[model samples]
Target: MELFNSALGKNITFVHPKFFIIGGLTGIPNITFYYVFLFFVYIVSVVGNTVVMAVIYLDHNLRTPKYIAVFNLAFVDLFGNTALVPKVLDIFLFGHYYIPYNDCLTFLFFCYTCLSLQSFNLVALSYDRMVAIIFPLHYQVKVTHRFMFSFIASLWVFTIIAVLISVGLLTRLSFCKSVVINSYFCDHGQIYRLACNDHFPSYVIACLYPVIIFWLPLAFILLSYLYIGYTLVKVATGEERLKALKTCTSHVILVANFFLPLVGTNIAAVASYIHPNARIINSTLTYTIPALLNPIIYALKTEEVMNAVKKLWKKKTFINTA
Candidate 1:
């Protein structure tokens, strides 16, 4: 309230609009097809993550710190899509672009939290990978179940704090100007920029959040792998090196799937002009596809998970036959 009051320095009261019309892709051609595609992605994401979780729960062999992290990844992927894609369908497909102010904030909160956690979950996987290869003998001691669980919990706490602060700050702004948000969702930047008063603080957050959510986590993962590579080269034979690196294939693919597009999008935004619709499509796909792929990658690429899945299938078949 103070933040809003402070900005209300004039004779008039602050003007906060009742609703904001999300202006993202509203004018694009054939975007309904994209929305339909997003719905399909959401369904696949839900089913895939559920199967991953089911396999983990059913297979005792997967009850390790690493699979625990994988489980977290699957869950985050599931939640992120559920929070985002459906609302997207409702807004664009069903023509409910006018979102109430409070609902917009809630929408931003869940979307950002899950997005941030996706990156952190990658960090968790990277930590497990780093400890496993770099300190092979002490991997168990270093990456215990308690440690991974605690680490993930701490990450959630931190991520929630960051996202909440962003949401909380939005309450202080008075949207006297345009109420139409320019992005594909109730974007933090689009909403804050609509404020009629001082929004420097929000601008600062806008600059800082990408670093926290994207770059910092990304650098940590990359550096951890670098150290793992160094340690591997120092001690292991060529055959052993390939074997160690093989374990990282799924993580690498997932990381690249999530981060590279983000990096590219940012770079494209900076280097040249991009159609708003094109940017929206790129951003939406970048977040969604990796989620759909996460469980599939684990089920197909990781031998343990593949074996567990096959075993589950065989068990189900035998029981039905018997």
Candidate 2:
């Protein structure tokens, strides 16, 4: 590119590959069975997230700042699963393993953008709950639709820019080594390491992405809850504390589902020698299972969402009968 040429100068002759072979999940035992299972996951994820989004959209009572984040979260979950699962099935199940370089980067962009947004969306939800619980009287003024929309928009812009910069850095890499990417998709780390030239920038991103996208959001959620707990203890009665804490059950479950497996797998990989097959499976599931479970958890655990769904169903039934 003109940008790449200008940045790296005329002396650098980059060996940009025409295509990358996705070799992850390539040789595990009975991988077809896993793909079949993922097929069903894709199905349920689509249905559940669709229902969640539809319910939020149709119900006037559910149109709060909190449900805005919930709707965004559901949308991201659906988009992420759609971006990931079908391509994965195509790559391994149907034996279409090769992806062009530009297409690969585009794939990485969609998948990672959606992935990052999931955590950011959770942060929004946590913030919503924190303000609602800790500053109930001021919540109306503090956590308005305008504020949430702005906050969530900024989060989206931030995630997109960070991911774009990382993807751009890959353009400078000269892959003199094997073109076979070790991860399931066009993984940033696997692709960059294959480059023969200086890849320190890519390496930095590989290290930093986890912290920015995962750990930071996780810490923020925990801190928000700590403040919520402190405020509840200082002001509310014991019964009141329990009632307030009950409101957070759905968010807590969502947080645990999203963060724990990712943190756990990263910790395990760092602490010991993990097999490639096992590591790949864990990482894949970490990306996937949460999307499948998020809407289900929210719908069942939050009485508001359940009631909204029932209300929408009853209205539909009434219209049909008329």
Candidate 3:
């Protein structure tokens, strides 16, 4: 770990084509330029997510539970992107691959913690939508400010405890020298790969934690929508029914697209633990593709988000014209 800050850290040991894809596509082969490219992504994700949150916050007309849920989701995502991207961009720019031991652990802890929080937030949002569609009158009282605040507080507490326990368990192990992470960030799975001791517990925890947290909520989201669709069919009014159906459809699509890749990646990570080839495929789906596609997914599926973005853009243009 002491070698992290030494001049030797500047020497590049490995350069894979996958890591240089952005540089290749951009026709700029310089390693320094790749750092700039990653920073561009970091800036776009932060700005776009921040705008989403701000739109939800400033627009009193958008103060429903569904949109409030979206606001919280965007807020968590903003934190998520910030926690991971800066370190990654810094490593690329400075040509320093070594992180101090404590800093490495801290990075892994918070990154996974934020990732857990974001996934849980998605689950909560799905439940909120489910209630709104399945029982409109009940949703107001059920998903009130007080209730949501308590719910979010509980989620943070639970996630922190789980992550701390996982980290404490991890801390007991010693890391050997094979530290070049195939993934951009120091993810828990990647970090565990370097552990010199028995890794059964780490693998078990990694597989079980995500499954319990992500899959359980995903099951609920799927079931809730199925019931919602059934109930919608019984409604009498055509226009009112269409409105309810449209909203439910949007929520279902968003939930599926988000959870499918997430769950698949988690499972793939387990397989990758055994087979090296699987890790590369999982890396592409988990890191590269999902980061780029999340905003596009929301825009394509949710008219509300699309309209809000358009409104925000037109306002920006008008201000510029003035």
CA-lDDT, candidates in order: 0.90, 0.92, 0.65
Single out the weakest 10-residue window by summed lDDT for candidate 1.
Answer: 1-10
Q: In what order do the candidates fall by TM-score, top score first? A: 2, 1, 3
lDDT of 2 by residue, 1-322 (tens): 4475577676666788999999998878888999999999999999999999999999989999999999999999999999999999999999999999889989999999999999999999999999999889999999999999999999999999999889888888888779999888989888898999999999999999989999899999999999999998899999999999999999999999999999888888888768878989999899999999999998899999999888888988999999
Backbone atom clashes (below 3 Å) for every candidate: 0, 0, 0
Q: Regarding TM-score, does 1 or 3 come out ahead?
A: 1
lDDT of 1: 0.90
> What is the lDDT for 100 in model 1?
90
TM-score of each model, in listed order? 0.95, 0.97, 0.74
Question: lDDT, candidate 2, residue 235?
Answer: 90
Candidate 3, residue 11: lDDT = 44
What does the lDDT read for residue 311 in candidate 1?
98
- Residue 267, candidate 3: how far off, in angstroms? 5.8
